[model samples]
Target: MSDKILIIDDEPGIRSSLRGILEDEGFNVQAVASGEEGLALIKRENFDVILLDIWLEGLDGLEVLKKLKEEEEKAQVIMITGHGSVETAVRAIKQGAYDFLEKPLSLEKVVVTVKNALHQKKLEEENLILRSKFRNKYQKLVGESPVIKELKKKIAKAAASKASVVIYGESGTGKELVARLIHQQSSRKNKKFIHINLAAIPEHLLPRELFGYIKGAFPEAASDKKGKVLLANGGTLFLDEIGEINPLLQIKLLHLLEKGIIEPEGSLEPIPVDVRIIATSQVNLAPLVRAKRFRDDLFFKINVLPIVIPPLRERKEDIPLLIDYYLDYFSLELGKKKKTMTSAAKKAFLNYSWPGNISELINVIERFVIMVPEDEIRPEHLSLLVEPRELQLTPQNNHILSLKEAILHFEKEYIHRRLMTNGWEVKRTAQELKVTPQELKEKIRSLGIRIAD
Candidate 1:
């Protein structure tokens, strides 16, 4: 659609000429004789640009500009006058006029100014959209528990430093959330925040994904591409599941950390980068280092400011707050009326050991919002999460099983029992095990336990 232009001038000839010029330039133009008519038209319709003569029959241009500023009208206003002065132009600009024009206006100058003003407005809109997206993705870390409070304090401290951070937590424990919180509070918050999950990316493609590649680097490389490391320059690079990266990739990452340079595939020249690294892992890197699976140097490098997010089981007191948050969030999202849970349902949630942490709880709440038709969620709506059974060690099995084998067997039986007790509801069984539903499903797979009768 063409930009809408409103011309407010006392002189009929000036309004007619301005409308003709703007309309011919592919603008939808409307001419008004006074500021009163202009403001009335503005109230009824949206205009991209307004041309107002300073001296009008009633409600002068400056007065209309003040009203527009007060009302927060987004249209760009240009002040036109035969007797234009430097002081008058400055005052009009201060009053939110996009530009000031002298009488006997040059049509070319008018078109250029309007174009620039529209371009500025477009940029402002784009910026607002980007900031809104950033806020949604990097929402404030919720929870007021002691553990959460401590983590917030530590995040504040870490934000002031340039040290590499490593967040340790189980799957679904908000490791990436912590990283984003740190980045948001840091000085580089306005820059990019690039995230890469090492475990998700294939091993053969990992290097090019991190360091980028040049044109003709491989058979599929038709054009040069920028990778996460380069795209994250002067910002933060979040490496999730850092321990899953292979040793060869570890060496490349270590080189980048030590040298602040990346050699893209098929490029000999090393490009300098100024990226802050924030790595997270579900398992302890120390064991991986000791077992010779991960590099000790790399471990030391990323573990500079280690932050451990406690599991939901450890911070069970925050479960209700999380439940309420998800309930309200999903209700609004799903366009459903707010649903309250019965005391028994609440108790069931509190008693259940959440293995997947906040992530699991969010999924459960979302499911309840969609499936639970009642205004109130009752005990039956909740999954049965009985107490986890104790590991049984029979004398016959103890003699044959190694410690690792015995623990594996016990875990298999424990998960199987929970699944059966919960009537094969994966979410409930996972909560009972204090693990995510996905994690529980993985265990069922590895143990070869079939839920089918």
Candidate 2:
């Protein structure tokens, strides 16, 4: 958008002329006669630049400027002074005025000042964006658990020093998050953190993806293009799923780690880079090395400071807190009212083993919010979960029970146990129990198991 400019002056001619000049220069200009009106405008709208006459009918220019700054209105203000007010102008300049121009204002000087102020504003905005990115990139790594605390400590330690790091974690355990946190807190925070998922890219194109390919280097080469290693120069390059990378590519990565230089695909010139290599893997490194699937030399090179993240099931205590965090997040994001998991539901959640860990829990919570009726989430609100028949039906005097009652009790126990085992996955439970879903539903209904809610 064109920069917004507010022209505030008691002189009618000055206001009109300044507005015309600013509008012609592609600014959104608004003219006000008094500093009072200008202050009101500042309160209600966002402006890029403000030109305030030192003398005004209501609030004085300096008073308005002070008020604007106090209100934290982020805009550049240039004070306009009358002749023989050099002292006043000097004081205004000291009080955060971008520039002081004498009245019978020069149009050229006005335009030039506006341009410079807007350019400075642009730089401020760019700096804000960079800071925001840094904050956002590490936001997912939220928690003060001992594990997380130690992980942050390790990240800070490794980031402060120039060392190769090997992040070890199960899939969906957020290994990438640890990698980003390290880079953001490091000395090289100003530079790039280029990430390449080794397993995601094709085997044949891995070399070209890591190292830039020159024009006519290969069959599809129409132009020279830079690769991640080159783009991530002076910063860090994170190789994700390092266990899946081919042995030859491992050698190439090892070469870069060892020599701090890489020869791009189909290029003879070796480009020197000061990139900190951070590699991650979900697999056990020792088994892979023993099997000869991974090069032992490369493993030793990248595994300088290893960080292991246990699976989600092992960290059940953090699940409830994670649920609250995600609930708040999704509520804001989806524009829904805030909700919480009921105690019964929380009990069911803790009882179930999360094979996919935090990732799986997040998915279940998302589904629960979208599907569960009413404002509160109950145990049955989790459609993703199933229950054993014993938990479903209560029976006394086992021998004295009728055949129909016995069948009902047995069905309830079976269904509830399967549900607990499968995290209440009804369809999977049905399939596992060798029963049609419709039959299972009927049985659950017949035993009043479906009436829990």
Candidate 3:
């Protein structure tokens, strides 16, 4: 974005001259007559840099800077005054003005100071946005399940203290979500929330990436760069898929945890960092530690507070609520009408083991809503059990049929054919027949169509 410059001066000549110069340099410039007008303009819009004149008609430059600091205290300001003095310059700097300029101002100094101040403002804005985004991304753990409630309580308990947390769960169980919640609830929420996927980064790069590197640290090093740990100073650093890290890096990680310091690549002196570590893994880290694949010291350092996310199958009671959540999400995301689950469909949802967990459920639900044009979801719509099972029309059937003789035969054929058309998933089958899982199961039972043992 082009830099926006706001010029506040009493003299029309000064305001016009500054605007012309800034505009020529490709900056969007706005000039106000007095400090009062400038303050009003500030309230209406955001500016990259401000040029404030010291001796205005009513409010002096110092007064304008003070009030501006009160509103957006971090704003970059360059003070301009005809009566330039050492005391005035010192006072301006003390009041958060970036630089003080004595009139008649050199065009070069004005341009250079404004450019540097705008660049500084841009960096600050980028850092603020990244921090805000990181905080908001972790605010989506919505559930009243006992497991979730206990998890929240635990996060609250651990957030205040400087404890390393380790989260363990299967794939798609929201392990990263749990890790972030811990960071946000902590006292360090306002600080950076740095995240890295251990599995995603290369083994050779992981060390430099986590601990940071110095200028000319290696052949490819153009300049010094702060790593995730340094970025997360005074906050939390999340190491995702920690179990997948290389064994050598595991040892280095242990060293950092023990020392509370990191020696950048090619550096001997260690840089101290005040950062809490939150590590997450899809598999149990304990086993890896025991096997010597992961360092035991590192595991202990990161396992102060442990959280495990139960699979969707284990918490079957929450399936209906999860479905509703996904339905609402997909409706808004796909721009479609609302979808509701029928009683029969809910039963089918309850019966099946969600092998892929919540992620799988979301994908299936999104497709189910978009493809199947139905007001309400029935039993056949619930894609609970997807594995193919051959059910023969035999007398000795476990699921009792609701019909008798020829009607039962026809119903059996109808259900079987529909299952074939649906590729044999309970959810798809229900959608094809415009029935719920409960209805499908009931009809299959009523007709004595049985799964062959």
Of the candidates shown, which would achieve the greatest lDDT relative to the real structure? 1
The runs of at least 3 residues in candidate 3 whose Cα sits more than 4 Å from the true structure, single-residue gaps closed, are: 1-138, 333-335, 369-375, 378-453
Backbone atom clashes (below 3 Å) for every candidate: 4, 18, 20
How do the candidates rank by TM-score, highest first?
1, 2, 3
Positional deviation of 183 in candidate 1, in angstroms? Answer: 0.8
Candidate maximizing TM-score: 1
TM-score for candidate 2, please give it: 0.58
Task: Give candidate 2 regions above 4 Å deviation.
Answer: 1-138, 384-453
lDDT by residue for model 1 (249-342), tens:
9999999999999988988778877889999989989999999999999988889999999998888788778777777778886899998776
Candidate 1: residue 46 Cα off by (Å): 36
Evaluate residue 139 in candidate 1 and report its C-alpha lDDT on the 0 to 100 scale.
63
lDDT of 3 by residue, 388-410 (tens): 22233444646665666646566
Ranking by lDDT: 1, 2, 3
Which RMSD values do the candidates have, in order? Answer: 15.9, 16.4, 15.2
TM-score preference between candidates 1 and 3, better one? 1
Worst 10 residues of 1 by lDDT: 383-392
How displaced is residue 317 in candidate 2, in Å?
1.1
